[model samples]
Target: MSPWVADIEAAVDSVLQAYHRPGLPGVSVGVLAQGEVRLRKGYGLADIAGRRPNAPDVPMRIASLSKQFLVTVVLMLEAEGALSIDDDVHRYLPDLPDYGTPVTLRDLMSNQSGVRDFLELRLLCGGNFSDPATADESYALVKSASRLNFRPGTAFAYSNSGFMLLTLIVERLEGRSLESVLQSRLLSPLGMTQTHLARSDIPWLAQRAVPYVVENGCAARGEWSIPLDGAGGMISSIDDLLKWARYVADPASPHAAHFRRMARARPYADGTDSPYGLGFTVMPYRGLDSFGHHGQLPGVFAEIAWFPQIDAALVLLANTTEINPFHLGRRLADALFPAALAPRFPPEVVPPGHYYDPGENRVLRVLRQPDGENYLDSAMTRAPVEWHQAGRFRPYWPMLHLQLAAQDDALVGHDGPRAVAYRRLPTGYAGAPERFTGTFYLPGLESLWRISLHDGQLTLALTGRFGTRHFHLTPLTDEVLIATPAQAPDGHYRPTLRITGAHGQRRLMITTDRTSRLVAGEMLPSTDR
Candidate 1:
């Protein structure tokens, strides 16, 4: 064993030890260097009441981490010339309504299809993830409510519905169940015997690491029964994940050629580049290239990050819903390799303007701080950013780098790939105040919004997870307005809100990038007396 192994082990232990509270669910972690397993361990409990101790070989749901397999199957079809990534998805699955432009296979795979996420859409529609549906049922739901957030390939919005379409495509092309294809093509060849894609019609495994959700104190078993075979459903162990991570970095693997092809960093139509590829996110963190994916559902959270440049991989599979594998994966990397961990974003020089990205029908504004700094504003979050050369920018704090649209002068780019595209707005725009004073509700989200006109300005309040958040609305145009969260006094959360109405009926739509891409939602008048 290397002498540095002790330091790495201790660092990882410090982080996991904190999660090892008595009666709470725990996690399984694996560390591999140069495609070799250096450390594999379990912390806390896999089943608290049954008293079954967690281990590296215990199987747990991998959630969206399963997307790579679906991506692989689709790429195989592409390789065989049966289908091309650029082909119109209507060629394979015509059930999906055409929202003007045809969404291509590449668009679906890369999250630029403008398709709304199936899971969140369900939630927005007064449904939860607990109820499982058949693949056909899931497809019909998205197609029935068929609408694209934006035109295909214009902006980036992660959509599970897009993957679900890919799932149908793969099955139709291969003429076999996705399970059989996954087993024969990727898993079997790689010798990953433990991993399997779970389906709705037939259950695969029996006993595995039990999943949990916290109650008042003790952890209790929880379930997320959403139809997830293509988008999120996956079951594997740490041992299996260790091999999968090694495979993720191995260019010699069966799908290495396809892997490299899919991993190519995507530059959006707006000239902004992001870390997301076909199914993987290829990012530069502290001077190293990290290839990884994170998956989450109720009662499960899984994440695996492979630094191909360093030949290092970090994985975390937790049965508990509260454990955020993405955050933990980053921390694990920091602990194992402490070199070059310092952050160097949110630069000192700030750009100030309202960038209008009509491609996605959104606005991104950066305002000057009294402290001489600049911050990005939105309804969701308010974070500081710094200007970089050649139309690029780096967010100092959140580890985001952006490539702006092709511009003559301004340093412009998305903080990361698939971010909003911004064109510097021209000078001189008018104001409209009385048009928006009303109560609106987004039925799908089960959330409410109130806009009021006071003293020729608009004040908006939204009931969110963090209670009601308030923002002062400034009109960019008669139809569009900018609302920066008052909580972020420094100006990081700038959400562009657009209102459309006719005959006393109105709709308010939000097009900001965050955990989920929100679009084309109704804003109904409040009946509250």
Candidate 2:
């Protein structure tokens, strides 16, 4: 092995040492250089009770990393003249509500379809991931959305609902199940015999790693009963994925044209390019050009990053929620190419406080850790910011290089092509929670929310598939409030409710990271109240 490769293998061991201990769920890591596998190994146990150690061949749920293969299937169909990326989505799935604009397959591929994410919609309806759902049911859920987040192709918003629609399109064209189409067309040709889609209706392989939720040094099995589709429902081992990585990286491969097309960034309506391409996030890391995707389920976290400049790739799959594959992939990349990476500097100190963005009607909490690290908190996500120069920093979420610069009275930046500014709010700013106390109904979603104030704390309660869930509401501005689940299954959904209109005609506009433009009208006082 070369000196650098040896150094990287050692670094991998050091980075994964924490998860390599006893009674813990662990990760399966693979590294590739020049289209060759340099390191393929596993750390920790796959099943704690069985005492089975994770191995390179142990299949695990890759979650959304399944998108690349799905996208490839779509491209293959296009090549066969079965479909076209430019074709309107309604051409294949006419059941989708007309949003008064053409939403093409390309828009879905590049996450520009403006479709509301069905998972977020399900959460809004008080449904949990553990709730049982069928493909038809999920399809109906997606079709029930009466509106889009924005006009198609105008902006970029990550939506799994788009992929779900694509899956339907592929299935309708091929007249076969997505699983069968993927296996016969892609996996079989690549000789990936061990890799296959895991459907909710079928039993999974016994050799698959057991997913766990590790807390306080204890491991518990994670629950996921919802049906798996093209959105995120595939199982594979590190060995099989390395085969895929090598094939995609090869310049002379048959699918080279498709890979290139998939890597090209899609431009917005105004001509600014998006960081995301067809099912992949195309962006620069440190100083190297890279394209990859990250996947997360209840108990799974997976990352695949390919650096085209050096013909190197890194894959990390973990069967535990505690593991962060994205950050680990970066660490492995640093070890693999130390000289090529840009130098890091301390983050510019923007005073830790609540900053409100008037354009988006949201609040961002800038927090400083005791160890001097800085983080940006938006809705339910918290991402670490790495500062490269004075007053400028980048967040590590969404796989987008979202940069923000500290200004005199505001932090201004661009999220892809859209400009955003977050002005710092006064310290200890509080809103009158009672003003938002009322019952509201959203006609589009057929969901109702009751906002109540008890003992100086406000909460929003809604009932659906999983029964009633009460979310604690914290005021961001006098008119904006953030709602968080009061119990377990936390962090899955944090939506912001903004009050609009006058007293008698007041309404609540709900927005999440994925779905927006949902408004709920306040119901009149009934006899029950």
Candidate 3:
């Protein structure tokens, strides 16, 4: 290995060792230079009970990084005249709802397909889909909702549902399961012995590293709602992924030059916004044009970043959600490969406000919430629901938002730039206040919000593994709620909340609370009568 490669490996080990705790479990790292694996290493224990350290050969769920590989297959097939990226999705799956305009494969690849994300709509319906077939139900749900976040070829929003729809198109055109197509084309041809399509019920992988979640000092296996076939769902070992990366990046390797075209960013359909290349995230991260995708499931956090200009890339995979692979890997690259690395984005630089609806902001004013005395003394059912932060719960200010409509009913709201969706329940709580005061768990975070009604107002308590604290909720109007924290000596928490619901179940109830410190004499407005 090159001396720089050795330094890169050592730096990675030091960071992981310094920040990692015993309970957080292990991670795998692979570094690619000039189209080959220059360094591969593993850290901590994969199975803590067995004292088994993570290894390069161990298979891990690549999550969204799998998108790069899936899109590669599509592009290669296109190059072979097997299919066209510009083909309409209805060409294969005619069953998809035709919303007057057709969505193309290119639109899906770039996330410009105006179709609402299936998973976002799925969560809105109180429907659960964990496996492949049932996962398709999310798309059907999106069709039933019949709402589009934007017109096809309009804007850039990361949408998993778009990738999933591409997977369906791949299957229908080839007349083979996405799993079979991948195994035959990518993994098999590349000689990736350890990599394979992930199955939700894979018994062998359970014994490998065991995706885990901790609750009350106990670690248990956790699962995600991602489909197994194509899109962002394949599993692989760091060693295998490194090899696959080499095959794609190597100019002399078969089909290598052809695949590079897929990585190149292109124009959106309307040519109005920056386009997402075939499969990879084609953007300038810190001024360096990088190609990679970030992936997260229930128990895994991953990122694979490749700077094609330098022919250098980094892959980081951790079993714990707390360990953000993307930030860590970027830091490692900066520390180890400074000259070729991308410049850091300044903190104060404002990102373009693409998702903003000025009308919504007109009705909303985000304010900071007061703090609780301690973890135990804090109320759970108040505005600015406590979010898990840096080993403790801190109040977050709700980014107050409003949507104008002729009818007073539930509505759909899209998650900022990520394209996720939430149901906006009608905000008339005076008659049925108790309906909003039950327990609800934040998906993926495992945090809980408990609300209780008393004295004609709502008392909300926020809790997680750390336990419960209280807050006050006073409905200002049919569409607004103001949250006050219990212990207000140092204005530490402010809650602004929006509730979204459908049918008999609440789909998305969000509280954006601002956390602040107490200032002398500003009395905490409490609903604790």
Off by over 4 Å in 2: 1-5, 388-390, 399-401, 429-431, 464-466, 490-492, 527-529
Return the top candidate by lDDT.
Answer: 2
The candidate, 2 or 3, that scores higher on lDDT is 2
TM-score for all models, in order of appearance: 0.73, 0.95, 0.68
**Residue pairs in clash, model 2:** none
The ten-residue window of minimal lDDT in model 1 covers 391-400
TM-score winner? 2
Model 2: weakest 10-residue lDDT segment is: 1-10
Quote the lDDT for 289 in model 1: 72
TM-score pick, better of 1 and 3: 1
Q: How well is each residue in 220-294 modelled by candidate 2, as lDDT tens digits?
A: 887887777788889989999999999999999998999998887888888987878898987677777888889
Model 1 CA deviation exceeding 4 Å by range: 1-6, 200-206, 215-218, 340-505, 510-529
Count of steric clashes across candidates, in order = 22, 0, 40
lDDT of 1 by residue, 223-332 (tens): 66566677777788999989888886788877789888767767778766656788876666666677778776656778888777667888898978665566577767
lDDT per residue (tens digit) for residues 1-529 in model 3: 3324447667676677753456546688888887767678877667777767777887778877888777877887888888888888878777776667777888877666766555534332332234334564555554563445566665555566677777877777789888888889888988998877774554566546766655455566555644455656778888887887777677787777656766676665444325356676654444566766667666676777787777887888776555556557666776656776443322211111111122231122222324322111111212232222222222221111111111122222322232222223333445566655555555332345656798877887655332455668766444345556564211223434445453234432342211111011111124111
Ranking by lDDT: 2, 1, 3
Instruction: Give the winner by TM-score: 1 or 2.
Output: 2
